[model samples]
Target chain A: MQMTKIKHHLTDALLMGYAAGTLPEAFNLVVATHISMCDTCRAALAEFEAVGGEVMLDAEPVDMAEDALADAMARIMNAPQTSLPKAKPAGGVFPAPLRDYVNGDLDRVKWRKIGGGVSQMVLKTEGGASVRLLRIPAGTAVPDHGHRGTELTLVLQGAFVDETDRFGAGDIEVANEDLNHTPVAEQGADCICLAATDAPLRFNALLPRIAQRFIGI
Target chain B: MLNEMHTLAKADAVTVMPVYKRTGNAGIRATGANRVMAEATTKRMAWVTQVAAVRDAKDKAAFAELFAYFAPRVKSFLMKSGASPDLAEECAQEVMVTLWNKAHLFDPAKASVSTWIFTIARNRRIDLLRKQKRPEPEDLPWGPEAEPEQADAMGLQQETEQLGQALAALPAEQRKLIERAYFGELSHSEIAAETGLPLGTIKSRIRLALERLRHTMK
Candidate 1:
């Protein structure tokens, strides 16, 4: 069926973390990007947000800084006209939130070849975790590896089949140390993914491991 | 007149019970129910109408209404999630300012005002939290369970209400984990540490709680 349905949607607890403001920025980006594309996750996030609202309403009301309203109004009046940063003009197939990070349309991403027919563009973000976009050629496979830490891979386009399952556009595969599989792109198209990892991967092959030291993959 | 008063008193009594059970405070729940219902309906409309006034017309009155509604609530939320009062208030102001500027991005088809505001407020809070310490890498909190697939769009409102009801019905232990994460702003590892439970237990308990919520809402 060529990846007709998403088999792996984000869980409620993760959505709760995203809604409640606990997830790290990298995870938050993954969740936000997924929510933009997945209707089910979007609806789920809204419910969590509604619950967040209810909880806020139920909290012990703190008396404001006496001039809070006045100051806020003053700031709003003098506020520099800031719009949400425009989505990248090269935002092809990229959702708005992800595009905010990608910063330009598809052509703008300066991909550097890492090795083995796979290239990557590491996104600069403020955190200990790392986020990057990977471009794997058609019919190629990511070096099979386990994670030293959690890894979240969200498909931006095309599809990849691994030992676990197939992930198409908008689907994310959450992998930790216990899971290891090579994600092989289907024959027809290249697979592009936004992947975030907090630690170096445990690559199975000797060559990728040596290259990892230099290439920082 | 006597009969009418009696009927209102009865109506108030009937309305209070479910909410009182949910909130554990009857006096507030009874009062809150009417106000919340009224606001919820207004917010649904505001996503379509009132928000546009702030965006297109620069309508101060419309902006004032949203500010009055969301600002303090956002502050309270940050406070509950571990921000100091001053920080929470400052972040709240930032959230409001961002709201003023980003009003153009408000898409009613995508999300309602509170949900969008919730995203902004929490983003500010999370950014503040991250500045304090980076989290250790860890697994996600369990997984997505099999379900009735996506709830139809028409069912979203009902699903949210049902979700609330289901949350209220959860066993205290499970609900406490949710509260710790949501209100306490603890990550899975931090939550595991604070509660002295194994990380796996925390994830599984939460996963079970969510599965129950999903099934109940479905």
Candidate 2:
């Protein structure tokens, strides 16, 4: 995959949580997808994971069963000797992680219209957070909204301009309850994003508020 | 949770540190920091060699040595993460088998052996306990073409060692918090609740290692 200039990156807490294997699956999807596209975050994740390595190293040792090594050796004999295939060139705009969720690339996503020229497909995930793929037609504006909790929006195709700034491909915008803003797709291309929200969003406009009930966003 | 993560945002803002840059023979100096760094480099490179022996020769003796040292530790790690003794034992064995199988993929420049094992074990925990799908980043387009430069590997190993030392040296309370987080005792929300965590203290060392890895990638 070609590298895009990624100005926004994951936070330390999210990185640490991912490294520690504590993030909810939806959030892990977002983190993995973002890291796939952004080398900077990938390097940061390695750092966080190193901390986990040290933690494990420093744990008090526990003795294994008397026959454990022999058992493992036998198992190793039976186990297929697998080596990682070298990474393939990406097939589309969605990275490997996102593609796994979609079952393929962009075309495979099963989107449901939420109204106003926007469509989304929520992926199955466990725990409290929810992740989805959103497609916004070019020049369309998503209704103004404030988050009830943390919302992570990662641009996958094209760009969007919010009150905060412009987010292009590979840029992730981390929004919490404190910020309320309207985001509009840039005029040139339809914007596709991978968004994960820990809680339901509260729409600023009344009509979409009713739509939110049916939309399950 | 928002309040705590907001604090995280603030903490992140103030903690960025300069990457540790090295020049020729800089690690050889006898002065305090350099001496410690060089010593760490020496002490930590052995694991890399042991992993290579397993990969290149399928050396059973080397595998035995590694198992003897790391298996018990891996068990301990799993147990701490709330695995039952039996489950932890079973999974720890699986983790070792994975290590031997994937030995060829080990990249010393990117991660120390322990770090690599930690990732494998971590994935196993998520799979075995949570039964969750763990999404991983795409691998770099190119695999390590050959054994990486010894210096780059050594530098990473040294940084990892220093990071361990720093964790050991942290005050008991802060260290316990970090340990709890790593041990899977703390959820992300719970980790956010901890206002006094010293995560910033170790960020610089990690950043330094990242810079080296990035430089090597280039």
Candidate 3:
């Protein structure tokens, strides 16, 4: 975790709009995808929705139309049964640039060990940049590492907690090189995170040097 | 009636007519459109119904029951989202009508019916907001209020109470963070600015708040 490498714009946009109910459908879909994999973002969005729900209570009540339900029932009782269209494979794993960050071959990439029970895979982005996926065993504390570039991490499963927050499945943590911190995975589940990085990680310990040489951290 | 029946036959020969017909072009249009839209809506509704069908009539009934339960809730939702009472009522009516017309679209795999319906309400609210030429006051409903004790409103009141209780169970810190972010219309940074807290703290607080809320709701 890097203290200065916080790239929270996507998270910010998602949290804000989700709270406001103003997020676009496409964006909401992406956000949903991210939240499903990342626990931190899910929690954040949930908080936003709850808050919105509360504010709604304070809103002045509106009178419902006389026949709204009857109309709806009439429509439902009369609605014809139909089938869903077939699922189509889009050009990318996801619909946008984010897709490229994921769906890459995980096995072929070089794996670098950064700490005990932690390994990383560095992948090249379309922008000719490199990103890393950091995997830690359950209850392992990742070595304190500072970021050197923009870092976007999406949690595929499990969860980890830092001094400031806890991230779970589908939660994305965006950070820059300036952010410095260490994250410890929760007991009983491995923390697997998909991280897109533009620069090398700055490891804080001598043990990392030995691990980096073989694992490429 | 003859003209509507003619249109219905041309669209989908299998379409069902309303049990009773009202008067005038409005009634004619409603009946005609309902018949046609029901046919059109079923194509999507089937996706949802397929999932519901497997669970049992109890499940199906629960799904079907959503119309009576949520139509007014959605109407009230529209009203709070800045629609007039009348427009909210209209939108609510349309939403339920849509729910009925597209009941088959309910896919339990993709989302719960509540979330799906909420998504529909959300989209409709956005469309309505976009169409407004001049912005009105923050809290006023756009249309005339219907009677509060109306059956629909009463139903909404009950559901809302349940939702409210769920919300209230969240920790005060988490709940307040959610409130400022959603109701207060403050950005994370803005919240940081107003509260004079660090931006990270605000974001973290919001994140924890949401997690707690989800746990409570579940």
Candidate 4:
């Protein structure tokens, strides 16, 4: 079977930092969001957590204050509940079709229209699971491009098709820089996806030759 | 209730019994009575406000309640991240205390409390790791036992025993790759490099492995 390579750096960074508990709060939020939606990343994270847990069992024990447990509970009894802050998308609430596609702390992404037919939103999650949301206009075709790194894409709405396969809402495609393919939106709709990539896109189109200079697709 | 009281009495005895045993049973009775009174007071006030009431009050009781549930988990997390046990313990306590002080700062609409706590623990763990000098390669803490093979064996054994059943149920290639990556921490590149397979193949294997694991875990 022909295979597609999913980028590894961002996912690896996310798993490593998540396992080590070294991810920053803002980035961690994005990882959590992505994990909520991405089964592959979620399972990868669980494995990392399990490994970390095993490592902890090997560490020497630290004694809490004899009264620490009791004190903690007492404080709990006296504590109060409050509303937590919501993470609003930096650009604004995403359209409904895009919600399932995006993950992580929403505030961290900086969305910019980098191309005529596309808008890109970038998110930095720890361990390199940086996120990019790409929205392609209806009937437009993205430059035939290969990745210099692994890329994972989840379609939130609409449809796109390459020579090998069709991606519809909720379909996930993992690609690498080795395989270059142009994705054209299916008739009558735009294609929006949540993508995690390690490096820039290598545009194969004449337009992108000029376009890539400014956009770094 | 009597069982709980007995446990409390035993715990309290460590400090009080030494003095009471020499001073006479009078002090024991006094201390026991005091514990009973304290326990009763705690129970009565437990209902003073539902823990969730902290949401509106300047102080949040629910945050404390959640911290109590997860702080130990966070402490163990730090230790695993390579913080000395002493450091881990200190950091754990600090996190819980911060939870208390910052309870009002929580915003549930953005992430669950567990996720929020996990983020805090993650940041703190990073801070602690960044401050330390790297350990000598030889001095690196080995697995708790001397047998590296046995450790991997046991880890696989347990993973298979618990997750093995699930593994058996996965596609053959997926299971193999998962065993290699999840248990081995082999990167896709490393897996490909070692197996002499293309990187794409490794990615698919891992992706499939994870998908299977997710289904099994669920």
Candidate 5:
């Protein structure tokens, strides 16, 4: 594992939404990928899940159908027993959740060049938000843009520096409508990020803004 | 060898819940409330044993006991979360069946039985109602495997009980907000709108558990 310190993390509200299973699939993908690498967020997620559990426990117990147990038992007997196969260690940058979307590791990603030596592969996810893998060449800067809603960018490999701070592997940058900054990949390695945006980005450059529609970014 | 023996002793201690007879009298809480609290905690602990039984022995009676207790609660949760009664019923059954199948995945040192069941039901709701795939975190192959100490499991269960009591003691409005959040009634923005949920202390214990699991994985 490349040992770059993770500075940014998932927000409490986002973690709670994930625990409640209410986040958009795109956001969930980003959160899950981050938690896979960051144990701090993993533990935080467990705490939110514990809160969900208590809420469920406090719910008034409604009566189920009289034959519910018997029916469930029958189903259990008929259903094929499923043992969750332990996930194989991902030797690549993408974690299990992102790997599932990419169909494999980083090498499997089918990249599409948008512009400026920057390439991306959009993963299909339901809901209003969109997630994609962005690969920026060494020392390259992604076009300056501001989010309309929320955008989550998780560093999978290498590091990126924006006006706010440096985000390295396992770090997640949560950008809302307030921030407009250009993220530049560090000089050593090409930065690979799994980013999810709830709304379209308003690019500062007119050319990229025009290209955004063609690229569906 | 000593560590193995210690683990065995702790496992034995956790299984003590099965020996206690179910009071089955939900209405008895009006009189001896303290005793009811103890019984509820014991009943919660018993679920750990029942899950283990279903996992190791495929014990039908144990599965039935778990179904009887949790199925109604799961259905009620789903119904409150906006699933129709019939859909809740169907999903509740599926959730129970999933419980039986995935019993081995339940780690008492990490989560209480209710927590485990809540996650299953929540995932099912997302898949069925929202029709969205839930991307789960990758599993650690070794699991909670430093041969989880029985003390850790007991402490976690106790903390979970305390958490439940704390939640129950919250002001009605605050409690209702929390319930709504977990029931999927609140959007992310709405959840952010609310503030000051009193989730204290238990977070450290869960974090410790995760650390232990991570350690064992290595």
Candidate 6:
């Protein structure tokens, strides 16, 4: 089997938060997507989950409302269909997990050009974080930028190399305020990524900065 | 092989939950309590087997047993994590419903029944909190997909027992941080700010504690 090289795995803090269900949806998506591809992180997550269960078992009990079980039964009887949503095929580029969000294949994504041969389509989700799919034509470079909050980018197709490392399909890059980089997609194919950011990016140049405001990035 | 057997034998000597069980029937706390406690322990340990029954056979009896045991525990958990009593009750109810709806997705290798139910409770509570402000997303995965391989029963049993031992051996300070992160539902920064510790210290303490846990349990 040819293993996908994923050099930049998520930090322990993020994974713990994800396991405990404390992270926002965007962060959870990144964590879940990365976990689908990385066995190492999946194991770490299992440990954290084990810890979560132990704490729960050890917690002092509080009396529940008398009708809680009956209420639960009522809800279950009327629960929204329990069947797993059938994720429309997204071919090979987008995994089933990501396809569920976009709701269709690559052709169905609603991309808007954000200038500089790059386009983005924001996926609406609950919570404050911003999540979007980005498309960069071959050899195109995003603005050199820092972060105001955590940003996680997972490469879906093609490849992008930044100041820190090169990421191909299935690899993830986690960036925060301490880091700054210009991510340029390698030539030969267009780079597509699912990027989730809790806050706006910090761009160095004036043109991109103005575009960022308009693009709602 | 002999060494592993020896470790397993030594592990069987420990009964870890005596320190943690909530007080029941204060008048009978001294007498007959041990029997009640033993029965409870047996019931708790067998929860995983019951969960598997729910998964494989759609056993209503098994699910009822789970609901009776876990519903109050989940409510207590949510309340301790700063939710109101009523909100906790509602979240717990929702969590149980999800359990019934999604029982087929539960895998013993991925987590113990307690762990699986705990994650569901935690997520359901968070979803309730978020639903107040915005609509919930329809696309989130069922959860982190652990490997598909069915784990060895003896190995999994030993891991759970050793996990309790590892948790018991942890220093109180490190244990508190872990409890706050997992059960108290506080993020690292929130825990740090609430505890007046530096963010880095909070992160490192949790990291160190998890490292010790993994080392010891393994």
DockQ of all candidates, in order? Answer: 0.20, 0.48, 0.13, 0.12, 0.51, 0.27
Query: lDDT of model 1 at residue B200?
Result: 31
> Could you arrange the candidates by TM-score from highest to lowest?
5, 2, 6, 1, 4, 3
Q: Where is model 5 more than 4 Å wrong at Cα?
A: A1-4, A82-87, B1-40, B144-147, B193-195, B216-218
Q: In candidate 6, what are the lDDT values of residues B1-218, reduced to their tens digit?
A: 33332333243221321222333432113247345444443444466566655565555555566776788888888887778898988888888777877776665534567777887887776667655222222232434443333322223433544464466567788768877787545763354323222123223333443344345544
The digit string of per-residue lDDT tens for model 2 on B59-166 reads 555566667678999999999998999999999999998889989788887788889999999999999988899999876644446556666676678778777877
Is 3 or 5 the stronger prediction by lDDT? 5
lDDT of 4 by residue, B50-107 (tens): 1224434433333334434456666765665566777877777766666655554443
Error of 5 at A15 (Å): 0.5
TM-score of chain A of each: 0.87, 0.94, 0.51, 0.59, 0.95, 0.88
Q: Supply candidate 3's per-residue lDDT for A23.
A: 39
Question: lDDT of model 1 at residue B115?
Answer: 59
Best by lDDT: 5
**Global Cα lDDT for candidate 6:** 0.67
Docking class of 3: incorrect
Better of 3 and 4 by lDDT: 3
User: B62-158 in candidate 5: lDDT tens per residue?
Assistant: 7767776788889999999899999999999999989988887888878899999999999999999999999998765544255355566666777
Fnat of each candidate: 0.31, 0.68, 0.21, 0.06, 0.75, 0.45
Best by TM-score: 5
TM-score of chain B of each: 0.52, 0.74, 0.40, 0.37, 0.78, 0.55
lDDT by candidate, in order shown: 0.64, 0.81, 0.49, 0.48, 0.82, 0.67
Candidate 2 residue runs with Cα over 4 Å from true position: A82-90, B1-40, B189-218
Query: What's the TM-score of each model vs. the native?
Result: 0.67, 0.86, 0.39, 0.47, 0.88, 0.74
Q: What is the interface RMSD of each candidate, in Å?
A: 9.6, 8.6, 10.2, 11.5, 6.4, 9.6
What lDDT tens digits, residue by residue, belong to model 3 across residues A127-212?
32344567788999888888775555666557888866887755567676568878888888678766655456777888775666
lDDT of 5 by residue, A1-217 (tens): 3334567888888999999999999999999999888877887787788888888877888888877777777787788756666657647777888889999998888999999999999999998899999999989999999999889999998899999999999999999889999999999999999999988998999989999999888
Clash pairs (backbone) in predicted model 6: none
